[model samples]
Target: MNAPWKSGSSGGRDQFAAYLCDDAAMDVLRPIVADLGWQPEKCCRGGLRNAVQSLSVTASPNILLVDLSESGDPLSDINALAEVCEPGTIVIAIGQVNDVRLYRDLVASGIHDYLLKPLSPVQVRDALTHAQAVYSAPRSHDAAGAKPHVSTAVIGTRGGVGTSTLATSLAWLFSADYKLPTALLDLDIHFGTGALCLDLEPGRGLTDAIENPSRIDGLFIERAMIRANDNLAILSAEAPISTPLMTDGSAFLQLAEEFRQAFEMTVIDMPRNMLINFPQLAAEVNVAVIVTEMTLASARDAIRMLSWFRAHAPQTRVLVVANKVQSALAEISKGDFEASIEAGIHLSIPYDLKASSLAAKLGQTFVDANRATKAGAAIRDLARLIAETGEAQADSTAKPSLLGKIDFKAMMPRTRKKAQAGG
Candidate 1:
């Protein structure tokens, strides 16, 4: 039982390694792995036996792909290898037979997934991509039995409700004030303003990552983000208006899982048009903040969104933020709004046109412009509440770090700068 398997002779090690018994399968898998940016040390034709022997001597990688087509008894071969495989290792079996019973048995015996033979490049790539997701899942629990990362989704009931503003502020506060590594992802590819709001240029890699999710990794993510500071990074794409934005639900979910693994906090500014994948995205996050105005139309839309969340993703904590609250305007009362929506108002941001416009003109966040203002204070409180809810225990008096500070004047556009100077 204590016998060690011989390690592979290959000098380099990789997070994902594969062992194939068939020459045809190896030919198909090698280039796919290379294209995915994985440098697997062992890609030889020893099959499951070779993999078992190799893993016995060396530590198992996060993901292990083994071919069981040649094994007489695939189940028995896998059981023997299970003794040496690491506890959290995700095993993906590629075999010649397409038996559902065998596949079910392998999964029951702790295998992550199974793939049939004659694997094309796309088939092998998708299987490995899914395996990466499983390996990246937060398996380690904290003292409170919570995952290490915090995922927050900011959804607007309708457009022009300052949802992006709130999401950006929360992300900035998490990185600057709370000193947490945060990722701000704006799902609105064409009309997204998260980068512009933060005075950072939109990156083209985001569109590439979304379109080709199989290529997403640490290096890809680092290249995709527009680094605002040491702890804060923004991921958004500014495609042309005519550019067709098409995406599947699985891509968004996979991307979100990767973000969760990469950052301490992940804040998403969801697009209003992405209703098809909104529920799936909301299910993955720890909290969902729905932004709405005080008008009846906004309240009606908020109720519909709330009902959908309750029916689909009940486990996710939901918070309703009433934005642009103006006492002069004829709007619904706070109590009536809560009663209609069946959720309390977690935050109520007073309408301050002057302060909001000034912050936008300067390309600075409201909290950065003046943290003591009503809107700024409310946003800070929202960030603190989200942190506390996620069990992140942030100090009440925390301030922005030097690296996190944004020079709004320098970041301002030349036209805006000239206009401001003339004024």
Candidate 2:
């Protein structure tokens, strides 16, 4: 008889391997083995890594079945598999028993799918099928040579409300927390703070792409990307003061479109003054996270901008974010800001000056620098909400790494004459 856990679904188990420790489970799986139609080379047992290594040499793409019922070290085996499993490896673990914590741990450690022990061939087949579906599914734009996904434009209604900071932090969050591939495309043109915000040095960034759009492609763009993580990439502004940046041009918009097509998620920290072609960009974007504070001046600008977008590009989603919501000084409430703008507030980010300033100076995101800080918590909450709604909410604590802190000016060796001849 099949294991009780086995179900009806084939689970999309076309070309996958199943590792079984117990003879009983192995025997149960034996009958369905032919039905699975997996390559003989794909099946094996020892540890997760051995199966992973088998697939690595083959490199033809296969599902991994790790029998975790054995007495050997579990964590060690998992670590070994983690080292070899690149982007495509779909790992399914056969656990000893139904343990919630173990399931969570395995899932957290990168296993694609999991099942409890007393494995039935049907259950194994189902898991394998599900895994293959994920593997064979259309590769996200993140992987090389794929069409990019939607882009988010982070713009400020008023100066100093932390648009750059929000963009930087959200990029970090989406890449780090969700494990979604993300690219930060700094579109602020001249005087963009994205490079400074991420603490990345400018070396043929957006400027190069804008000036030479014809030469841009996945490989060229890949080289331009600074690795935010395995999942996240960043393209900073071209040199802020480069003479080529002075003219209003269509090239910038073209670059943005390329970014939109090249990344799973692209975030643009736009310049305050909308350049001539930016309206084209704004219209094409998936989400525009408009940052505003409580003051009347900021609110007025935000309203005007909202109205312009509403009239010109009604199809795009515009999220009016009330940033720095908290203040010692009396300011208009969230309700008032929404009323004045005639647009609903999408998210309210509290004012945490201390954390925000530290993040800016250190060139790290607030979510990284101080997760415990109010601002950091707010951003995390906001990120989760956006991910759920498939929306963008105007969004920092991150401290720059020691290496990230070095700048062009600091890198140059200072010539110290005789320091007053040893004083």
Candidate 3:
């Protein structure tokens, strides 16, 4: 079990609280609460809904035991409770049902443990003791050198530059190839394709976090993010266009903080406007990947974005990737574009329209669908560059890469010149 999921930092709140719908449950729970040195009077004569109402106004306790016996839709109501509860609260759901599937689902949703009602003092005590241990582990882990985290914010200089494509591919490579647990956070709100690129349905995770920033924690993150694989999970949304995006960007920052503790790498497909509206969102970002095309608009916007990063987030590494490169069709030459931005191009992916279509038709990432193509190879090189940035940060003498270098910078911008250079 993930100890972070059991994260229980009791920030000035009660040590434990319970809302039971029945009197018998309370009679059994009170004695155990007193034994643990928690205030037994904290247990009230209500169910999950009451806990939601009370916690919405006050800080959540270190450990919570909520009665789900009364909830008509326990899973849905659990999500509702998540909206009100603060992070670092270990939740234990008590219900009358004894289905193995239900127990697994509840634990997966961040509950420390689910106790079937007819609550035995011994079973409850043992569960609480284990939850208490889990609650105390993260603080010690932090003291003993927290795991290194890498965060790359992928931004499009202009729309339709395949920014989401590049972002999703990088996340997939980190998880699938490198075997690092990764998260892809698509901040496009109304028009994100981070989940779609992976053939996943965008869940309510991102929107839920936006609506209830306080609810975000290891458990909320585990439940909210739709898993793409064993190692990769994504938080994205297809919010209604009619309903405008609302938030001060605090939720995104909080989500990123939790991710730093939970996963090894996080790739954020952040749109240009969001970055401009909330510059502080990049404060935790380790690298800023500027995805663009060989267009005059892309060059102009990339310059503006480069200057913004230099001014606002100088600590973050900047990588310029020119995507969908078609030398003959390009409005501006790569040399001219680089000159315009005052930065060198880190990687330029040649356009392969057929391979791209094949990826979409099969519902796979570009690199995965067409690994033999130039574009796919270029994307892999980009992934390596981004992955190594974190390694370099953790130790000056990072582990040597097994991959032979692919010199993306040596490839020429013009097709004929590139052919001649290669020959």
Candidate 4:
């Protein structure tokens, strides 16, 4: 199926920018460039002099690949790009010299990647694809001063129902798929597996973070987390069977609030028994993902939880997800499950014993096991759906009001004012 995120029917052209000055390189890369998902209008080809001149007037591109082999003066090309390339533009330089010095220099100057080319379309596509992937990985600083973060609480109806698994998977997918920073907090004080799930054994995440929640900032949180992958970061204690930790709801809120300040997405895997205080949490959350099973008791409890949110936190979006769905005939169907809970099944992750076992044994998410698995693909789709739907909802709510202008720059850097004419 085609990705729903791709906008259509607006006659909007899909474009990307590429620069190739060498005739030989252009011949080899033209087809490859086409395959990289960019149009001719999105690409600009010229010698070093012409390309540099056009840089000031050209629109910023999502991806830029320049053949530095033909351009003897790489500095000039780099300078031109640095001035006009957008904040997150991905640039790859193809060079003749395989010298480490040149590669290091370009990378240090903020070029995403460098490739030594005799030139193949596959190679160009691969390099550009990788650069786009890396460049799109969201940085922690983006949310530093932007709007408040969205905190999602992923709680399981039963203990062994894989709350930590679901939470970590969702967090990792959010960070990896949407290219947004995500933080997963294991709220289970006595027995939390968030650290184990991501194969991270940090000193003390929640324990240390809660001790002096007042000092929780981006730096502090960064030091507390264990970097799991390119996008996902885990925050929790070291050992699963560790000693008791002192953490009250106030401390939790304080840490969560800081997480909100630092990360684009924050997910708290609240303990199932802690649902007694669901109202309190629902009021503060932007969304709550409730993971349940086919069992009747679990369904009943999920229904109650849904009703609780509907009655109390009407503004919060509650998503019901069925985890470890064994078979089509085991119990309730999708329609019945939704009817029972009175909330649609936002996501249904099929049972993948091999993937789940490997992840559990190695303390990794299924998506990390192998990106091509059924579970991995489903999680990617789920993440994309969540992100797009949220964006659509936000767009719908954003309308020009009585005020002459609307500030659509929610989480972007402030624009510098034009200098006064004679001041």
Candidate 5:
């Protein structure tokens, strides 16, 4: 069982395979499998236990369908199956149970989808089609030299707090200075300045994906995103304000998934309203940058957002950044604002109206436009900290290679003996 939203198929894997407990279900799944142009023999006769045994010996398929009907405890059997299943294989389970709690539990356990027994051809076909879509969704790795994707979402506690500026600057620093492949996702669908700040024409790619969520894939990503430089690309939109938002937020999520697959770093310029309406969008983010000033309103909203994240997305690391700080002419003192939010302001960017205006006038990111300013120096420091965080995450999750584990010096004696013997 893998994350429903995340899956992949490695090399030498069949496009589709199934293990059915009975003939009736197999009959339903067979024709649909064939409709997808797959071989009928791939749909085998068995159940979850058989799947575990078979996959243990052979490579797992890209899309694995297993029957849980014969199992006494589905969850336990699924765990057993997981032990043998390869990483990133998309798994679908067919079972007789129709309980909603069971479905939620199975989803939490990482099953891609669960189908109740007595399935119809149409239902099977639909499920299989959706599974294929998930399979075809962009993946982060294809075997060698796979990289860890770090996602950061930047939000403003209040309007006119320079959230976009910080987002753009951080993205620029990551791409131009730290040299990480980066993607800047502007969630402000109608009024985004992301492309404008970088002197780019806002494209219709985001709007197209919003109109048709199913069309999102690797190819779609490659075609839709506008490259900003050798290492940076951005997907932004300028939809007409008259049009209403019709999506259930799935398009944005699908975009986030695609970003994870396509770029090493994803900086999402998420509006506060989006955070309120679409909380799930923040689920996979590695960090959240909350930009605010030392004002009572900002402090109150920061407090609320900090609590919201603790309750909703506790896994994400929160970084509170106070922007446009002027110690002499501040609404609230830095210490008082920190006390109000009950968390320290991680970084405070000093007020530099001239620097900010110059960046906007030049159509450049603040860090790129005002490197000599103290505000620029602070942003660069923030970027360094963020980069270090990424490096630490990479180090923590890195898997030791075979070569790394080999003791070459210790093996030299054996090598010398072999050389002397001329074997």
Candidate 6:
């Protein structure tokens, strides 16, 4: 079965672009391109590299056809091409391998479609025809002058930092308190506790949606979501211990887009194991929240994660939440932690062991169980800040006036051997 394109309707392919194999593949594709009414200048030889080099010097067409038969690492090659490719460019890859994994990976990485090689005119025509249709489809936009959907991804610098707890509270505030349609996606398939935290049961909708994206639609999503209340719903799964759960990068992109269309705000509980795909996922969202604590080890890892986001998803606004904060007994003070990272801590949730443990046992959220507590009040404020405005103002007192004055490498603790040798 042919995979469906997200938009557009069938029409002429005069504006399409292609980079095909130099030998028989080009000969086979030439007549097909002409029959479809695409321009000859849009077609070129030299495969993925040629397409990248050409796009660097000129504008990218609406559609891009890359021949990956000769590529030893097609995934990496496609990623390089994507950096130079235009925003709306629909990429269709042609390769000799018929592997299901390869097809899934390419689709997951944002390619429009994939056609197995040893070329055929019929396949080429059909794929391009579908691409043209999707390109022509009208895009869905929010009502005129309405705020666009906001998506926030909450990722932990290290495990056991209460990332899921914070994500859940944020979703609850958006739906229950602020009265906006909210979706909390637990991307952690195996050990996810998003459902349990809300006192709801895990469903199979997320798993099915990832495995077969074509089946995803409004009805499918509605059925998959477990309703917590009138405004809030959750999409999560509970995988069996023996069953191996794997994530498809493209499927996640599709899922995130779908969530944005259906809700005003979406909070994602990102799993640490999916770090490989985090950059792609991070790029799709408007806000990224990194959950860490007041510790040297957490600080080191947080710096690395912050640096990665700076490089991969620079456009995304980042916030650091210092969870379980305790300055009295802690080795590093909050001010020192913020100074080391070169970014102010956006929110600080005080460490309250008694309240946290009680809430966990009762399967109730911290804010719900202890609304009067310090931690509960802090979480509520965080939600209001995100809901009303997309960002929180950094504490001017804590945040350094100039980032250039702070040397991050010098802040980290050095081993005794290195310190002694330097001396």
List the global CA lDDT of all models.
0.72, 0.60, 0.77, 0.61, 0.77, 0.71
Write down the worst ten-residue block by lDDT for model 6: 410-419
Give the least accurate 10-residue stretch of model 4, judged by summed lDDT: 413-422
Tell me the lDDT of model 3 at 261. Answer: 74
What is the TM-score of each predicted model, taking all chains together?
Answer: 0.66, 0.55, 0.62, 0.55, 0.75, 0.68
What candidate 6 gets wrong by more than 4 Å, as runs, is 1-19, 22-138, 142-147, 391-423
- Alpha-carbon shift of residue 261 in model 1 (angstroms): 2.7
Q: State the lDDT at 100 in candidate 3.
A: 43
318-359 per-residue lDDT for model 3 (tens digits): 999999899999999988888888899999999899998999
In candidate 4, position 295 carries an lDDT of: 76
Give the better candidate number (2 or 6) by TM-score.
6
Higher-lDDT candidate of 4 and 6: 6
- Residue-wise C-alpha lDDT for candidate 5, range 153-219, written one tens digit per residue: 8999999999999998999999999798999999999999999889899789999988876678679
lDDT of 4 at 201: 77
How many steric overlaps are in each model, in order? 1, 18, 0, 0, 0, 8
- Give the per-residue lDDT of model 6 (tens digit) for 1-423: 111232232232237778887678787777878887877667788898787777665556677788997788998777677656544566778877766446545644666667766777866776677566656555454235434677888989888999999998888888888888999999988789999899989889888876765556567878889998898999998888788864445456657766766787899999755655434566556777899988898899889888987876665677898899887877688888988988899999999999888888888877788888899998887787666556232111123211121111111110111111211
**Top-TM-score candidate index:** 5
Per-residue lDDT of model 4, residues 363-389, tens digit only: 767677757887677666666665655
lDDT of 1 by residue, 310-371 (tens): 77666577889989888678488888888988889999998888888888888887777768
Report the lDDT of model 6 for residue 257: 60
